[model samples]
Target chain A: MTRKRFVTLTLIPAIGLLATLALVSIAGAIWFSVMNRTLRSADYEFVGLHNFLRLLRDRRFFNALENSIIWEAITVIGTLTLAVLLAVLIFETVKKPLWRNLICFAFLVPVLLPRVAAAFIWRFLYSPSLGVINYLCGLVGIGPVEFLANPSLALISVAVVDIWQWGLFFTVILLKLLETLPREPIEAAKLDSARTWEIHAYVTLPMLKGPLISLTLVKAVESLRSFDLIFVMTGGGPGTATETLDLYAYQMGINMGGRISYASAMSVLLLIVTTMAFVIIWKAGKKWTN
Target chain B: MANITCKNIVKSYGAHPVIEGLNLEISDREFVVFLGPSGCGKSTMLRMIAGLEEVSAGHIAIGGTDVTDLPPGERGVAMVFQSYALYPHMTVADNITFGLRRQGNSRAEIAPRLKQVADLLGLTPFLERRPKNLSGGQQQRVAMARAMIKTPKVFLFDEPLSNLDAKLREKLRTEIRKIHMQLKTTTIFVTHDQLEAMTIADRIVLMRDGQIEQMGTPDEIFERPRSRFVADFIGTPAMNFVRAEIRAGDELCASGGGLTLTLSPHSFPDLVAGQKVELGLRPARMELCGQNSHNAIHGTVVLVENMGAEGQVITNVAGAEVSFVTKDFRSLSPGDPVTFSIAPDHIHVFDPETGRSLRKD
Candidate 1:
């Protein structure tokens, strides 16, 4: 056989499988939205753009979209910032290897636990009464505060749980990247009379830009589809304060209401949003890496 | 410029001792090269002097001030790492002026110093480019410029040219010497390459197994090595060692490998009859001679390595192999008869047991 035939034969199966899965799922979603379709209905009626029109008029859909944007912004920024700071502290500042390992392992415990379990654990911790958080607050003379029960604090509380569960992912990745950074530049910085903070600001942070951007992109994409933690913890309660796009889509199609066509439209919109986010982040990552 | 004094320095890792009870005084504006094999702790010694490594026990003083406990940043010294270590994110100009800026130098002061270093290192055009954008030699220039712009009391180089190619190493080696002459900073350079130490050093401190084997000027160290280790380490193809017994009579002589040599009266004055000694002859100092010459060792050529301007002729002297370099290479082939001669003044005698040179000089 010719080389080109052999190469084509070898690559066709893998590429075909992935392409088929992606095209079929996307095409099915678009088809269901364009046609009047329900989960239990036997009849399929063509209703062009009816579900999207209804989605445009839906206020709850806009609220969910806004909440999702807020959720992604908070979780991605908070996780990355806190992870970088903690990683630096554990890896650079803490010289003892034993202590570094112990601290890293402690942070990794939350990541190892399932997200639903983490949500439940945080739910108990954020309880107004009989929770350790309020007890600690009582010691500081602060009254019991409703964390998940209040509309203002509900989204933030859920975001905090997500941060707690997934922040270690960033920490582990960034820590590995930090370990591989060239030692000479840091030693040079030290000999150049840069103090600890100055070294981090000028040398360490600038060198970390590539990894930071890549990890930010990862975390942003991951948080966009976040559902399990919110589903377990808040359930979009307190007047939908913590309702995100993923949770609203699930609730519309499978939970409180059965609006599969409307849900398909929402999923298609989410797909577009995610694709745009990934493109923007990828461009930013390329610029920084260069 | 300032002198550096290391007194009874000791460095150990847990139970393993690296540098032990070492003492050396580097005069102001002196360029000293620490020459040794790998793991001799020469780099560690330089690091100790730069305050990058903590001295286990001893005092290191720069100029007249004791700086044993100070951090590297406070030690008033600059170092060029083997890897060059220019900040990849910063421009060449920023890398050169980073120390000055960190020390809170005004922009006016920093600009002139940066410009001076850039011009000196021929980095003026590439000042705006980052380290990754520059070539290896350009990055090395940035590293040197960074250290030079500081103008610290002492400069430390940890095998800075070992990473470069052979041609680049030679070029940079000469450039380093020129820079040293222009700045006259008390500099300590650590390298395992004896050639680098020989060409660039005002004084060569030869180290062996974490201790100072010998220290002297290049000529003194090369011509009058104090130990067998020094003689073997400081020369290419190394100095040849022949085990011989001293014959005492009206004139002293050493005989080994069926070859005999008469020793000068001033050489090994305390030698007794029938004492075992190792005789050292540098390959470059020994010369090819006609057969049956007086005071000559006869041998047959085993290998002739023609190195362009010079040739290394390895010959079998009795049962032992002896090699020498000669420029008069004309149709020399293996299995040909050859004779080599060494002057009495050029011979080095060492105690067989201790490897200590017995030659008084």
Candidate 2:
């Protein structure tokens, strides 16, 4: 085949995607202008950069922004720490490949489950009255405690569900990374009189830095976009305490009212934040690997 | 440095035997090599000695202590693997002093040990570099230095120089010999390369099919092999084998070939006249005896391999392919009928069926 034909075949998908993006951008610009016309010119208008000034005064927006940051922080640290710990433990302790594979399979079950289904499953388990957790706590003389029902505990509860459902994803990936590492150096370390803990600390841990950074980047972006699990578990309950940007956009655009333009604005903000996080992570990864 | 001994060592995987009831004794300060082909239990034997492989039915003693049940570290033997097995993440200094640090040695203790080993291996310049950043020979030195700094009872090398290029192999080969000489540490090196075994070993233990074929000094094994197998295994271009039979007139004749030579009847006086035998001649032993020379055979030269400084000439002798090496490269060419003879003392007679050398007691 000629080089031109090859180039056409490869570029066709990119061209198609760009065309769709251009058409969507055109329709969106027109719709945004129409929406801006109905509102007052001072508060919300097509006047360039006016809404950004109002956005600075928005309390709920700031609260959502703070919550998003806190959410990402907790998720990234929690997932990476737990995943690496679990992977290292299984790598050093598990001798049977079959048993290790089975454990990995069990971890992947949560990641494979539909997000809504997993959230609901966790919701039932955390239900205050007849939930197994409360019932078990009662055996230890503890009273019924609101997990997702309490406004103070709502975000934490949502994070717990996210960690439980997707922590396995990190565990499995990192576990494979650990298993594929050369065994000879570790053997040499053992011969070198390195204690079990020292082997993990000096040898295995340093080797795992690459995989850990990669998993952190992926799980951080994933946590920022997480919507289904939190929605099903808490519905931003009690005082919009667990109101993430994704839930806020859904609540405003679809559930509360047809504030499509407002939700779109929130979406553009989420997209920018996520894109910035990804670009930083990609750059860091490139620096590390290079 | 300490001596090591294996008593009735046996190892098997499931039902297949790898090391079958083997035994060996290594004296203190001796550089010993287990020379064999792949899958001949040489590495298995070394691993058992290092406590890396379980001895199925034997006891291992190091420095007069029974260590068959001990772990590798407690056995006080450090091993340099074929892959170097240097921790890629650690700098050269850290890799060398890892064992000392783990043994609860203070930085004061480890620092000097590291410095001494690094200096010994000429690795002081690369102390801060990681193993992956170093050349293969340097990495091998790092591995040796790591094992050395531990000051174990025995140093075990499992084909340590096999991964290097030919030039580096020779360079590291001499370096290893010099290190062994300086340290005077008891070492057991395992390799399939006969050249490495011959060049570096104080005593070479040749193994085949999970058994020791012969064990002796390099000179003894090379000049006087105990069996046809050892004769065939030790030399480069390998020893040539030609089947022969004792004829009615008590002459040695090349079997199925029209070649005849006088035999010293006293050499095999006990064997029947018609008994079959094999003659062993190293390539370097066979010389270009002149035409019409006594006990000489005329052979058509088949191929002339002119390596620098020497030549390996393959010839068709009495329908048998015989190879010989000569210092004079231009002395012979292919298709030339050349006469060659081997001295009676240079010739090894073997029982053709069992491949055992027939030594006169």
Candidate 3:
């Protein structure tokens, strides 16, 4: 066979297959959202904007949207902040390489565990009666406080669990980036009389802006679509306090009341929100880098 | 505007000692260049002085105060790194004024100092631009501007021009000299380039194996090196070494590689008969001579290098390669027999065991 024919047959088919899969997934969601469809009945009708309009007015949908936004915001900020602090404290300050590696490895235990396993472990720790956290709190004279059972604390408890599981992800990535930073600028800062905190603030963090933004965008999107931990831990407990957009869509579409069309609409809206978030971060990253 | 002093400074890492028992003193406004090859501890000495490296033992003082234990910011010295270490995210103005801002200088005070430094380094136009937007030379200038704005007691430069091209290195070398003259700050510059040390330093401190081999003015170090290492290290194309045995008779004669030459009576006062020594001869000092000329050595030309204004002739003289520079290259070619002569005063004798020069004067 000629080179041109081989290239056309091989490359085009692979690319066409990927493009077709992506296009179908997106087009199928939009099509099902616009039609009155159900899993139980074969008969259906085109209902323009019915599911979206109801979604806009539904208080439970609004509550889930707010919870998702808060969850994403807290997870991204908390994880990044904790990751940077821990990486700098453990990796940069520790002089012995063996000790540094040991500490870093210990901190990465959560990441090594499966997400569902991590959720189970955190659920046990957050147990109000027999958990270590409440036991320690009891010793400190504070009464046993409900972590995942209280309406006010359920969302935060789930967010904390997400932060614990993923903060190490940022720590490993940012630590590698920190190690690759040119030492001369840091030494230059030292000679210029910059204090430790000031050096990190003015020189180190600014240099890390590109990687930090990219990581934040990635983690933000990941947190937005997160389901396994919240499913295992809270399961939208305490009257929908921890019910995020992902969980809410799963419940509406696949669980007891299978409003498949309405679930498809919610998923489409979530996709739009995540895409918009990614675009904003990407644009901000480009602007800062340039 | 202050003197700097290092007393018995030693730096070591783990079980390996890098700099050993070093001491140096620089008077006010004196420019000293520490010259050595890579890994010779010149940079380590400079970093120690800047308070960036902790002294393994001993004390350092800037001006009159001992600053050995002080943090780098409180030591009152500024350093320009070899990489030019300009903050990539900051504007030129911000990079220059970062230290001043940290010192709590208000905008009113920082503005003029920033402008003055920018003007001195010709960085006024690029004040608002980031370091990446500038050329290599411009980035170097920004590094200089950053260091100069502090106006500390001393300036430390760690091979600041090593990263630049030859032409820019030469230009910046002269600019640095001018800045030193204007500021009159006790400056310590470290470099391996002999030309840079010779051209810019008031005194050159040549180091080897973590200890100072020689410290003197450029002309003194060039003309009268204290040891074989100093002679070998300071000259371009390097000085030649020929193993010779001293023969004492009515006239003292040194012979090596089938060539013999008479030495001056006072060349080595402590010399004894049958002592083995090494003779050092600079390439530029040897001259092509006729076969019957006094102190002439015969050799066959192996290679001829034409260096525009002058040519270097590398010749095989009695199984030893001897190179000399000469302006008259018209009659030279490979395989041609040549004779060269060196004056008695130009010859340097070193003890073969210790590599120390035997000359008393």
Candidate 4:
């Protein structure tokens, strides 16, 4: 076979499978969203824009939107900040390869835990009476604290769980990237009288801009679509305190109300926003790196 | 005021000692080149002076102040690295003034000084471009401009031209000397390139095995090498060595391989009869001569490396090949007989085992 023909034949299985799965699901969703489809009443009628208009007036949908924004913002910022801090600390301080690798592995153990398993683990840790965290808090004279129960702390508490899993995973990646970065500029900054913090803030962080932006976008998308951690930990509990858009859409369509068309509309909205964000971030990163 | 004194400086990595008990004094505004083979302690010594590498046991004083514990910036020294480590995201202007800006100088305070240094280094045109956009030579100038703008008491260059092409290296070498002449900073440059050391250094400190092998001016080093390593490391078409034996004649003479030369009696006063020595002859010092000329050696041409201005002719003499540079363009091919003569003073004598020059001062 010609090289081009062989390449095309090799790519067809993966490309064709992915394209078919995505197109069929999106077409089905679009079709269902325009009709008043419900599990309770199977005889559906075409009702254009009616479900979308219901979403516009739905108080639960607005509450889920607010919760998702807070969750994604806090989670992405916290994860990225910890990644930079830990990566720089280890890169600068840890001398031997054996120690560096061991430290990184300890932080990475959380990533090996399944998200559902991690949710259960965090739920126990946040328990007011049985948790060792509360026991330590008592030593500090602070709490029998309601970590997952209080309305103001529920989303942040869950966001911290996501941060714990992803932040260290990215720290290892950033540390490897730091190894590839030329260290002479940092040394030159030292001779320029840059304090240690100034060198990292001005020189090292600016150099890592491209990778950090890409990580930020990925973390944003992952936090927005997160559902299992909240499901196992709070079940969007304490009166919808941790109900993100993903969990709200699922609960509205499947559990509490069988409004499948409305959930499809919410999925479509999420897809559009994610694609726009990815393109913008990718473009800005390209401009900066080049 | 910026004269440097290093007293018994020693550097070690755990137990591996790199520099051991090295002591030297550098005068204010003196340009010294640390010349050596790779793995010699030239760069380590330079770093010790810059306070980048801490000396294990020594006292270092700069400008009459003990700066052994000071940082590089606080020691009033700046360095141009081998790789030209300019901040990639910063523009030429920003990089040049980074030192002043970091020291809390405002933009308006540094603008006039930056312009002056940029114009001095011919970097005014590239002041706004990033380092990635500039050529290798241009980036090197930016590194120099960064140092020059600081107006420090000492300038340390660690093989700053090793990355450039030949023509660019030569150009920058001359420009660096000119900068030294103009600024008169106490400069210490480290390079394994002997030509670079020869062209730019007011004094060459040739090092070997973590110690000073020889130290002198360029002409003193070339004319009177104190050891075999200095003669070999400091010349292009390096100085040739031939085994010889000292003989008692009317005066002391070195005779070997159908060649004999009258040695200066004042130079080799310790040499007795039947002493084995190595006769060192520079290729540039030997001249092509006629068959019957005095102090001439006869050989068969083994190979000829022909350049337009000058060429090196490798000739076989008594089972040893001796090469010499000749400006005499003749139609010479392999298997042809050749004769070359050397002046009596140009013949260097060294003890074969110790490799130390026998010439007494």
What is the RMSD, in Å, between candidate 1 and the native fold over all Cα?
A: 2.1
Predicted complex 2: DockQ: 0.70
| Candidate 2 lDDT, B17-69, residue by residue in tens | 88888888999999999999899999989888887778889899999999999
DockQ order of candidates, best first? Answer: 1, 3, 4, 2
Q: Could you give the TM-score of chain B for each candidate, in order?
A: 0.98, 0.95, 0.98, 0.98
Question: lDDT tens string, model 3, B141-245?
Answer: 999899899988889999999999999999999999999888888899999999999999999999999999999999999988999999999887789899999
Report the C-alpha lDDT of model 3 over A1-290, residue by residue, as the tens digit.
99999988889988999999998998998999999888788888999999999999989899999989899899999999989887776655877878867766777788889889988998899899988999999999986989999999998988898888789767877776888899989988998888888888899989998888888888877887678889999998788999988889889889957888999899899889878878887897899787
Error of 4 at A158 (Å): 0.8
Clashes of each: 0, 0, 0, 0
Candidate 2 displacement at residue B210 in angstroms:
2.0
Ranking by TM-score: 4, 3, 1, 2
Q: lDDT tens digits, residues A155-271, model 4?
A: 888889999999999999899888888978887887888877888888888888888878887887778767999999998977899998889989978997898999988877777
After superposing candidate 4, which stretches have Cα over 4 Å from the reference? none
Measured against the true structure, the TM-scores of the candidates, in listed sequence, are 0.95, 0.91, 0.96, 0.98
Task: Spell out the clash pairs found in candidate 2.
Answer: none
**Interface RMSD, candidate 4?**
0.9
TM-score of 3: 0.96
Which prediction has more favorable DockQ, 1 or 2?
Answer: 1
